[model samples]
Target: MARRRRPKRSNKEARRRAIYLLPNLFTTASLFSGFFAMIEAIDGNFLVASAAIFASLIFDGLDGRVARATNTTSRFGVEYDSLADLVAFGAAPAVMFYVWALRPLGRLGFLAAFLFAACGALRLARFNVQSDSAKPSKHFVGLPIPAAASMLAGTVMMWTQTSLVEPIPAWVAVAMVFVLSFLMVSNIPYLSFKSLGLARLRSFNGLVACLLLFVLVALQPYVMGFALLALYVVGGPLGARLLERGKAEKEQAEQLEHKPDHS
Candidate 1:
């Protein structure tokens, strides 16, 4: 009997094998979640759309961690992740919110949603070019696109879950989308929680505070997400200004103290 020969992998097949599977699977799931959100929005299921956007966020977060942990990060993975983010965190949230609240506003509503998605795309592009490098910075250069999307998703979820007498005004939703869009592209320094090292807090009080915060979030998750996003979005610019003012004051004081007494 003749010996059976195994077929060899071609160059393209080799290249395909080089790409990471597990991380990309997560990214695909995120993209699917985003698509599902969009479909839900089209079907007039705002609540489910909001939830899908949140689910997309979870998948998006996992993809990077999985890639990093597995030592399988690659250029293909980075590009794929960004594309998934654009779909999941950019288009899905924008469309979901628009259908939820902005639909009644006509052209203004569509423009607002378009702007949010556009800004998110810009944010993702900037991140890929600048911050996506291996060097970790203390803070993000801009409000992350995911965070902006979360702001939308969390707000929708909050309104849907909570009992409120008056429905949220359409104008308010318009203004919020506009603000979030700009924030996504702004140069404000948003804290990167990934760099915070919360696990290694210096004091017992810090741990207790963290635990208390977790409990609060558990109690009122929708409120907590919305509240935290609001704080973070507003805090970025305020924090930047304060930091600059402090730096200028410190420099001025140092100059005064170092000056040879001119008296």
Candidate 2:
């Protein structure tokens, strides 16, 4: 029998092969989750929509880790991730929230959502440009897009799961729209987990804490997610203050160490 010939891969084909599959799959899933969340919101399933948004967050977190682990991180992946984020974290949430809660407030509701979407885009743009030299100090320059979206989603989940009086109080929802939108564009610093890679091992105590957190989340997912998102939103200002205080103390200590002896 004659030997069978294998088809040759072109350079472009070879590059395509290098892209990771599992991670990209996760990314696509995240994008779909976000898209579905929007559909759920429009269908009046606010609870499901909110939950889907959070689910998207999980997928987003997984994609990067999977890519890194598989050595498949690439410029294409990065670009795709950002685009998905804009749709999932920025546009979907804005539209969902506006129609769900903010719509009652008339034009102001949509305006706030619009601001959030615009600010989110700007934030993503800044991140892309500054990713190389971004500081890992105690905080981020602005509220992360994902975090902002999570906050909104978490709040909705909290209200729904807790059987709270209302899924979203008109006043609170309005205020939140403005607050979240501002945070997205503000100069406030927030934590970035990028430096804390998945490989970092925690102490036994930390492991216990993680277990406890898991339990709490399992027991009261709505409350836990709500508290977590709220804490993270507050964490920015708190972290910034702590960073400033630490800087001041360090400067003072250095000055004392270098002071001349009176003797």
Candidate 3:
């Protein structure tokens, strides 16, 4: 008697599995980059470590877009991405900063690094919860972990390029870490830029602006990267304050217009 053969999987199922794996693969690349950054940092290769973090940032950005484009997004992907982010944008940067500039402060330095990671974890958790329950908005509720990580990485690159003999002041590093941690957990609105439709822009001026930006960045990546991240870090709070002031003025004007004239 011939033995019965096991049923073979369908091509559709195989293809589906492969497609779903794509985004997770990108997430793994990001995680690997972040882990490499930590290792480089420990070995005192800070410039390499900073570059790795930025590499991780690029991978992190691509995974979400790939998932969405392929319509293969799932809860597993979301959670995996968050875990990768906590490593890439949280622990890795903390370790890099701690080793590069925070080591002199000893306990305060390490603690500040830990605080940044913890705040990043909290930020990711809050974002996940909000994404699941709230309507999708054009703004993020707090500073994105990647942006915060990029800021630190940019600082490292910029500092390395500077001609100053003195190391970054301990107080300045500590203050920067503390402020970034606070911003991560704060409620300030940060533009997500998801609604910009950059992929489908129809204007020549927009294309020229983007080309100019690329040229400028290529000319002085370290300086430009730090400057851009710094502007983004400050823009959230400044923009909010400006919007509040405008609203107040508009309300005052409306009240004045409604007032009865005494003639």
lDDT of 2 by residue, 49-111 (tens): 988888899999999988878777777788888999998999889988988888888888888
lDDT of 1 at 68: 84
For model 1, how does the per-residue alpha-carbon lDDT over 112-223 read when each residue is reduced to its tens digit? 9999999999999988888555477889888999888888888888898888636689989999999889888998889988888876779999888989999999999989
Collision count of model 1:
0
Cα lDDT for residue 23, candidate 3: 94
**Off by more than 4 A, model 1:** 1-17, 132-134
TM-score of candidate 1 relative to the true fold:
0.89
Task: Report lDDT per candidate.
Answer: 0.89, 0.85, 0.94
Quick one: ranking by lDDT, best first? 3, 1, 2
lDDT of each residue in 184-254, candidate 3, tens digit only:
99999899878788989999999999999999999988899999999999999998788789999999999
Cα lDDT, model 2, residue 211: 88
Clashes within 3 Å, all models in order: 0, 1, 0
TM-score of 3: 0.89
